[model samples]
Target: MTAVGAPQERAELAPLVTEPERPAPARRSPRRRGRMASWLLYAALAAVTVAFVYPFVWLVSASFKPRSEVFDNKLIPDTFTLDNYVQVWHEAPMALWLLNTVIVTVLATAAVTVSSAMVAWGFSYFRFRGRGPLFGLVLATMMLPGAVTMIPTYLIWNSLGQVGTLTPLWAQNLFGSAFYIFLLRQFFLGLPRELFEAARMDGANQWQVFTRIALPLTRPALVVTALFEFQAAWTDLMRPLIYLRDSSTFTIPRGLKAMLDQFGFGGEWHWEIVVTASVIATVPMIVLFFLGQRHFVEGIATTGSKG
Candidate 1:
């Protein structure tokens, strides 16, 4: 090989010039990672909240809108009016229907709560033969389809000459609900047997023990049962439809059905009034749910945790 020139030799001997290596990216700390996860969770929750709440918000907005603009799909109304609300009261016996709903709900809720608590206390406190089998039978009743019993129930009610009034709507609740009994029984079982023994030592009767100790300790469960029954009675349309022949006896749901017939299907295109009434019907339930939300959640949590 030919000898290289001095400049070429010097150039070859020089170190190669290249870009410096970058430092590896800093690893995320646990706190940073947790913050990121929390933000993501918050964003997801906000999205779900909007998804669930937007329809109700739209309904409320529509209720305040003019008839032509009610279905315009706008969240904000260009023309706002309370005329729909005002006119709905005049068009229907809204006050009477509301009163009937309140009465029925209160009666049914009270009946079921007391009856179910009593049954639950018996199941929890009493140690007797066939107790398990008896509870199993009670639970089994829940499996029977409402449709299967509807005709028989109606016949029984008809035989008693109480089919037409609000009696059927609430009277059935005089017998403890299987599900409520089960829920409350779990709470009762979690109570220390020694507490009842102490109460007994103190000369407290079984009724006293239940009233003073069981009911107070298991208040959350009772509230849950009452709330559930209240919702059921408040929204019950089936019994009302089956028995209520007169418009004067109609509850909210039955009244709403009549209003739908009048406004939605009938010649009267007063859909705004229907929407307004819907808003009225829905607000009470929302208010109640918010009020009982803490007890509701606590009751469910405690029930699930208990035996």
Candidate 2:
């Protein structure tokens, strides 16, 4: 009987040992697999990052390289120089173009920010007849391509005697933009109503509540919207081309094109200067984007939160 009991005990011990060993193997397998997957995900992200970064790297590198070396596809040049920048400065009215762009972008962005915020505040806080329809109209305008209205817009500006002037370029923002209005409206809607109510109880009017409480809380959205407007104004080629007939009034894009035209296709082609101009044109927008990146992301994230 003792021997039989010993055998049964050994059998139970064996089962327990085998069960622990099985879990150990399974756990090891999953851990190894998880590590492999993690590595793969990181690798993929690195690849994507490189893919996006490569173009800007090439553009910057090309700006410093000679025309003959631009198409070499090399990651780094054996020789880099600032001759392109010097030539671009001397040849084109780059400084003037940059100044014009800055003026238009700053004014337009300011107009859009203030007007859009006001409209958004009204739409969100005020109860009025046709409010929903008005907001719908704003959204609907976004669906209409700019190309569709370009000719008509040009004609209207021309009739208003604003053609061939910077007024036409910046005047469009006087009425604000549909997209920006919608964006700001959505952002305004996300604010806590209690804050506004409390402000009202404290003798704060609507304008005071907006200027103090709403604007402060919506800084991220405002910054992002202003940045977007700035970029659009800076990079705009068509509006400037259509409205600006004077070289002195040209924006960077228009100035770049004019430079290309002046150089032509023959021996006069200054690829270095053109490349440098392109780089300079891109720098301000890049700086603005990096500076406002955090706010931009936050604004987009919160824009639709309450809507």
Candidate 3:
């Protein structure tokens, strides 16, 4: 009788062993949220990239499109034509303009790099009276708008009989630029002082120390400065407009402007030709940037770190 009662009690308890029925909470996992956020961020970046890159793509496509399709907003043209480039080459003195640009840009870049680096070395290594104040003054000059002194600068160049020449355009940079001086000074300051001291101990004169020790170590900075100044001279329009009087002396920027001015915007618009000229003019600068890009980044990083 005891055995039978124990079996009956065990069977009754088995039915109550199951859990109460309830719904599970619908919360997202952390990994799921993170993945969603990453996707959103990528989407935003892609949109911004498209916005900036679309214009350049359109410009290149327009250069290849027929005149009737030049103004179209499509990235792929309905009809492609090389006549625009052909006309640009025939109608404009692009070769002469490119040659002039090359001369001015190279000269200006070399001069500015040398002058600015020398000035920067002085500011970094030499301890002189009012040195800080003088550097401050140089930086202050950068704050003033170019327009404020444009007329006075033009008049001064006119007095020197260089107003209608590329000499006036590049002469100012050869003296040194405030911004370039600042950039090079930061890089020079970051260099190892012990090396410079050792060179001096070995009877190295100031010029010798500068040329042999400092310059070789600061190659990255120099390349960056040269690239910057090169691009500045390459794209300068106002300076060329003010200085270059003869058509033969016009730089690429000035020549392109002349083409636009000659062809009024309307039914007679020469959009395709102008775009073609622009594409040709832009290639050199792009190539230069890519070639010096590694040094450029290193220089910026070195200067920024020390600053």
Candidate 4:
């Protein structure tokens, strides 16, 4: 009986002993192929970067070379000189041309920015009769070819006595751009309605709400719109050619054309001078783009995300 009791007690103690918890299997790291794929992607991107940048590098190199070597496919010139720059200045009124470009770009960009913002605010915030039709008309303008309206616009400006001057260049801003207005209106529509309601409840007028709340929140859109306007105005050739008759008022592109005409591709073409002028014309835009790149990226990203 004593042996039987001992055996039973041993059996009960064996049942109380539990197994320890096993650790989870370690997760396998990502495959080597994935890492190789990432490296290959980076290599492809680097090649593409070089392809885009090499042309500009060649342009600068060509600008420094003498006319005899301007067409050489060399990455670096054996000789470099500033004579081309001096000739460019002497041959044309580049200084005045640049100044005129600056004025037109600045004024047009400002007008477009302010007017677009105001129009966007109204379209986004207001509700009225024919509102849908008006907005639809604005969208329709974007579809119309700018060239189609060129003659009509010229006629209207001519009738208003604004032709042959800078007025026509900027007067279009009063109506605001269809594209920019739509861009900004989309941005405004993304804003919290409660904020506008709160402003109104606080006795804020529509103008005050726009000035204080809407404008501040929509800064990215404004910057992008302004940048676009600036670039357009800066590089515009047709408007200036049609409106400006005086050589003194020539913008950079027009002035460059005149320089090329003097050089006469038929004989003794000063390729160096032409290339140098091209470099100079492009430098300011490059600087502006790089300086504002951060804002541009932010603005475009947010606009797309919100819209």
Whole-model lDDT per candidate: 0.88, 0.83, 0.85, 0.83
Off by over 4 Å in 2: 1-29, 264-267, 300-307
Worst 10 residues of 2 by lDDT: 19-28
TM of each candidate vs. truth: 0.86, 0.84, 0.85, 0.83
Error of 1 at 205 (Å): 1.9
Better of 2 and 3 by lDDT: 3
Candidate 4 global lDDT? 0.83
Best candidate (score: TM-score): 1
Clashes of each: 0, 0, 0, 0
Ranked by lDDT, the better of candidates 1 and 4 is: 1
**Model 4, residue pairs in steric clash:** none
Question: Which segments of candidate 1 are over 4 A away from where they belong?
Answer: 1-40, 300-307
What would the per-residue lDDT of candidate 1 be over residues 1-307, giving only the tens digit for each residue? 1112336766554334222543333333466886898799999999999999999999999999999999999988999898898889999999999998998999999999999999999999999999999999998998898999899889998999987788888988988999899999988888899999999999999899999988999998899999888888999888999988789888899999999999988879888988889888889899989999987787667656753
Worst 10 residues of 4 by lDDT: 19-28
Displacement of residue 91 (Cα, Å) in model 2 is 1.2
lDDT of 4 by residue, 86-175 (tens): 888887789999998888888899999999999998999999999999999998998998899899888998999877677887778867
Where model 4 places Cα greater than 4 Å from the true spot, the runs are 1-32, 264-268, 298-307
